[model samples]
Target: MNNIEFKHLILTAKYFTKYEPIIDTKTDDIYAYEALSKFEIDNNLISTEDIFRHLHHNNKLFFELEKRNKQLQFESFTENKKLFLNFDADIFVSCEQQSYWELFLNNKKDDIVVEITENGSDDETSANIMRNFSSWLNNKNIETALDDFGQDGSMFSFYMMNGSKYIKIDKSFLRQIELNYNYMHYLKGILTTIRLNGQKSIIEGIETQRDYDLVKELGCDYMQGYFFEELMIIK
Candidate 1:
């Protein structure tokens, strides 16, 4: 999509936020909610990945749309639980933009966690951008999470891994565990390391009672997926 076409779609699209609850394993209660963006245009839903892939061509436009999305997410969230807001590393384009977001998130540090997401770009440049942005978020006293840690094209930065307050294991790990018991061993090791570092581990894609039971036994600090609750529209 060209800039003009993208802009037109942005203006015409019906954008909303859906929240998926992150559950604390011990309490089996809601720990936080991750704000997921949904976009529908002309009665057809567009995948978030597709929207982001197109927006990657324009950093300024990406930031603008995300700014609005954040607003909607924040406004629509009524629960006192912490909210996980996805922040693309590429959107930190300028000092001016940083200043804008600084002011925007000034009072929300205590209640927000900026999840660092690397979609299509996960090269050295993208990793560097995320590292710097992660530092900035840390400085602002906002919690940060390394999203999709083991996904393809998602760079594993030790700096980011150690610094993040939360490390979310991707859904694929669950599938792998089911296929091979060795994968379960690997997950246990990962979870062990995460706990040793004093960081919490959140396992994603717990879609069944068996999945929940298995993940719970693995000692993940939190769990998120359809097994707990389906994504609920924010408004």
Candidate 2:
């Protein structure tokens, strides 16, 4: 879809249920529905990167969409459960934090976890910018989560310094942790460090019984994967 069409589609779109990992030993309650933005054209999700790129290119459209999303999130939270909002670091850094905080002030700030997804801008400049932006977010009581960590050599020191609250271990590590003892040990060390430093752990991309078993054994606090359920629309 073109940029204008894509913007309109996402602004008016409803949320779909994406899998969210649950605590260990949980079965029926192992997953939760996360909102997924979709376009009406053939009813498919627009590429997340494309949406952000359009937003970056079109300032007016970006502000409008952000305002609309903030309103929708506030309204939805009154009745719906907590929300894990996906945020591109580039878009986040570009926007005014005061505006976002004012919009969400009436709602529970802790209930809103900002997800910093992978595949966004990942250069030195981008990383430095995000570090500063994260510092601003931290002051506002907004939790920061580094989505899809361990995929690259971006380094975790920035996150630690910026006081990120959670780090989502990339799915690849979870997939192989069961068979690779050394890998598992490595992960355990990482998890231990994260915990020792007072950060939360989220294991993503889980899709099997064995995967769940391994993460649970490793004492992961949260999980998200397709094995529990695919994304679905709530309304």
lDDT (CA) per prediction: 0.85, 0.62
In terms of TM-score, the best-performing candidate is 1
Candidate 2 per-residue lDDT, tens place, 1-235, comes to: 6776766677776543232433333443533334444333346655445555666656557656656654554455433445666654444554464466545643656566776654355567767766765776677777777767786554455563337787878887975665676799888887888888888887877788888778778886777777666433343
Shift of residue 50 alpha carbon in model 2, Å: 4.5
* Pairs of colliding residues, candidate 2: 16-232, 17-231, 17-232, 21-223, 21-224
Off by over 4 Å in 2: 1-21, 24-33, 47-50, 53-56, 77-81, 94-97, 152-156, 160-162, 176-181, 230-233
TM-score of each: 0.95, 0.76
Q: Who wins the lDDT comparison?
A: 1
- Candidate 1 on 1-235: residue-level lDDT in tens? 5688877787668887779899999989899999988889768887566778777777888887888878888988999899999988777758988988998888788889989888567677777888899888888888899999898666878999987999999999989878887899889999999999999999999899999999879988999998866544466
RMSD of each: 1.5, 3.7
